[model samples]
Target chain A: MSEASKSARPDGSNRPAVQLRSAVALLGSFPALAGVDLDVHHNDVALLQGPNGAGKTTLLRLCAGLIGPSSGTAMVLGQDVGSANGRRRVRRSVGLMGHSTALYDDLTVEQNVQFWAAASKAESETVVPALDRTGLAGRLQTVKVSALSAGQRRRTALAVLLCRRPSLWLLDEPHAGLDKDGRELVNGLVLEAKDAGATILIASHDLDWATSVATRRIDVVGGRVVEGTVVEDAVVKGTVVKDADA
Target chain B: MLSDARLIAAKDLRIEASSRVLLTQVLPFGLMVLLLFGFGISPDRQVLGEVPRRSVLEQVSPGLFWITVLFAALLGLGRSFSIEAADGNLDGLRLGGLDPAGIFLGKAAAVIVQLAVLEVIVGVGAILLFGVSLANVGLLAVTIVGATVAIGCAGTLYATLAAGQRVRETLVPLLVLPVLAPVLLGATQATEAALFGPVSDGWPWAGLLGAFALLYIAIGIVAFGSFLEES
Candidate 1:
């Protein structure tokens, strides 16, 4: 798994974990990611902050190979993410945690994690320790996800992420719906994964919470990454992008 | 690839077992459809004893059986994707590294399992309630397998096409039913020939059904990735 994560270019140098060159993606004729250019290296913890509809989620989805760039190139782990073979290979080594927990309402927590773990080609035995790491050890294997609280549900999703051990973690709002303890678990997990050499890209509105763990931070607004700070402008609903030089 | 397909199919089947939605709801609805057709066709036989009830039922049983199976199978197809859409489990599956072709095959296979069980119960009920008998049971088997495969593959493919859309519920039937007209015609005619004798046209109908099934399976394998990404 570690060897697979070190995806090398033709010249044998390891490629940037994610690289987007003037990439454009459309959602219903509207550009979601409009001419975006960015790069993140291996083990880099890059944080993305923006107002709603600023293309944060779209960028993450693009990196996850869930959406293709309408124009330009979006590469992840040396693969052109727009291609089918590239997307399939990228999916094998990347994990994306989005708004949804993605857990089955009827399946038990253990079963949910086990299913993902196996799908990610991890050993089934990793499920137990993953659950333990996420502080869901008390929940019985028979307990359904629908029966769990919001925090517990988040923890279960975290457990699946831990077990999969993806090379790249694309997380959108990791702290959403989590309590203080749950947030701390997320913080520790991110740092831990980075220490183990996994690249991380996180998109979140809560700048203060994410700032502490982020190695690099960028602001996005109006579907493009701006060299700016996010200001609370009531007119734009908290999406005022003020240039850094301003 | 087959292993991935088997894993996905197993997971889907486990979820179905836990919910019991197909068994408790869909199966009963199919039987009710059969019963309703029985009443609708044989209305007050004492008043109108012009045509024999047994002969009329026998004549209509092939169409009724296929219709009931199609309607009941719709329930499973809709629910199959609805469960995934509930919390974005579909995204999880996509990111889980399973090949898109494998996912399609696995989902279609699970639907086949469900429809096969539904067909057995409904077929038996049709035989008894409609007083229909089989002449060439072998041809009947061929028709069932080919038709069920056709429906399952087409259903899974079309269901994913509308997986996350607002009008997915209405859109699925519209997309799937029209495409499935050939399967219905072939299966119904094949069953008719199988039941009444000669087995002449039944073979050709079964062949057509098999061809449609293979075509769908191939299309699903090659096309699911693009369709899934769009959805």
Candidate 2:
């Protein structure tokens, strides 16, 4: 295993990597995440499907420790997500790909990845192959991100995430600007990360593509999870109601 | 934390090296300010001719030098944060295992480097254009270093405080300049003593600049996380 994987919880606790109990997050006057209760275990490929302004991005940001819950509990890697110190502890192990590419426009593709790798404390040796995996090998040393198309930018973002080798991937709209080949690449990357013992929570409007590889489907609307809509794999058509007391 | 700061600082410096925006835009802006001051004060030629032109320019160079630093430093600090906003790299940094204080230091250090360059160019422009002779080179150096740190640290803090906002460009200066008045006063007065009076006379003001620098650096390190996560 790569050195980046060493950030996984070393104690090997049986607890789910992510657990939210009535998690509420607010942006200004509106509640982005009204009250979300979710549990995603290690290696679980959970797909979050929601419409616009449905709190999908907020949930992912909360899980990534980029935002804190306004109320109730949200935990990642067994650390409280609402506290500053707790957020810092989980950040090293979690990789988030959001609506923005999170890249330096002035830096070349290679420098962008290497900078992130250094910041993520990943092995420098892993940078080039990560670029190759994302189909950015040719553009690696030559292209500035400002000169790339949106799809190419997305691929470069993926390459940076790949370098981190994070155990938990919180991806918001991971395939938004990608082409057919790029979409396939994202699916492959998700599966690859899962196979490597990573837990993935992806938010996407592309339900068909998202569910294709999802271990479970979580439907979110109006900033709340629809009751009994968390479906497991095997094309199950039933909704298992969660405990009211939970 | 230190390693993370170094990584971020290096990345910013590389970006500046590639774009040359600081050199091509901000540095020229500093020099323009120096020239404008010369023109603005040219009206005083009759009263100033009584003393040597150098002596007259020396009296006012301190204020003009600091004013140039203040405005030019703002351009660099705003650009520093805007680069992070480019790819949500700021959020990326937060999630990449770097603490907020590390980001603060890295960015401030980069700004300090840029401002130090600006200081040098502006300093030379002041000496030649304003006809001011250096009195205490050592004190001037110390004052510039201290004033640069204070501005860099405080400017970075305010830049991030206004990050991701639409009116950030307008807001950053309003938020930073008012807060930096003490720095401006201290730097101006310290530079005056370094230029005209004995170097020892400026030491207390230099101490004030040093204290301000330390205070802002501490505030940045303590508050960067909270301010950064706001977006």
**Model 2 chain A poorest 10 in a row by lDDT:** A237-246
Best by TM-score: 2
Show where candidate 1 strays beyond 4 Å: A1-15, A228-246, B43-53
Among all windows of 10 consecutive residues in model 2 chain B, the one with the lowest summed lDDT is: B43-52
The 0-to-1 C-alpha lDDT of every candidate, in the order given, reads 0.84, 0.84
Alpha-carbon error at A85 in model 2, in Å? Answer: 2.1
lDDT digits (tens) for residues B1-231 of candidate 2: 787788889999999999999989999989998898888786345434544344445577899899999999889988998898776877887888777899899999999999998898898888888877778888888899899999999999999978878788898899999999999999999998888776777999999999999999999999988888774
- Pairs in clash, predicted candidate 2: none
Q: For model 1, how does the per-residue alpha-carbon lDDT over B1-231 read when each residue is reduced to its tens digit?
A: 788899889989989998899989999999999999998887333323534334676786899999999988888899989888889888898888887898899999999999999999999999899877767989999999999999999999998988888888888888889989899999999998898755998999999999999999999999988888777
Single out the weakest 10-residue window by summed lDDT for candidate 1 chain B. Answer: B43-52
Winning candidate number (lDDT): 1
lDDT of 1 by residue, A98-190 (tens): 998899998898889888898888998889888877877764556988898887888899899999898889889998888877777787788
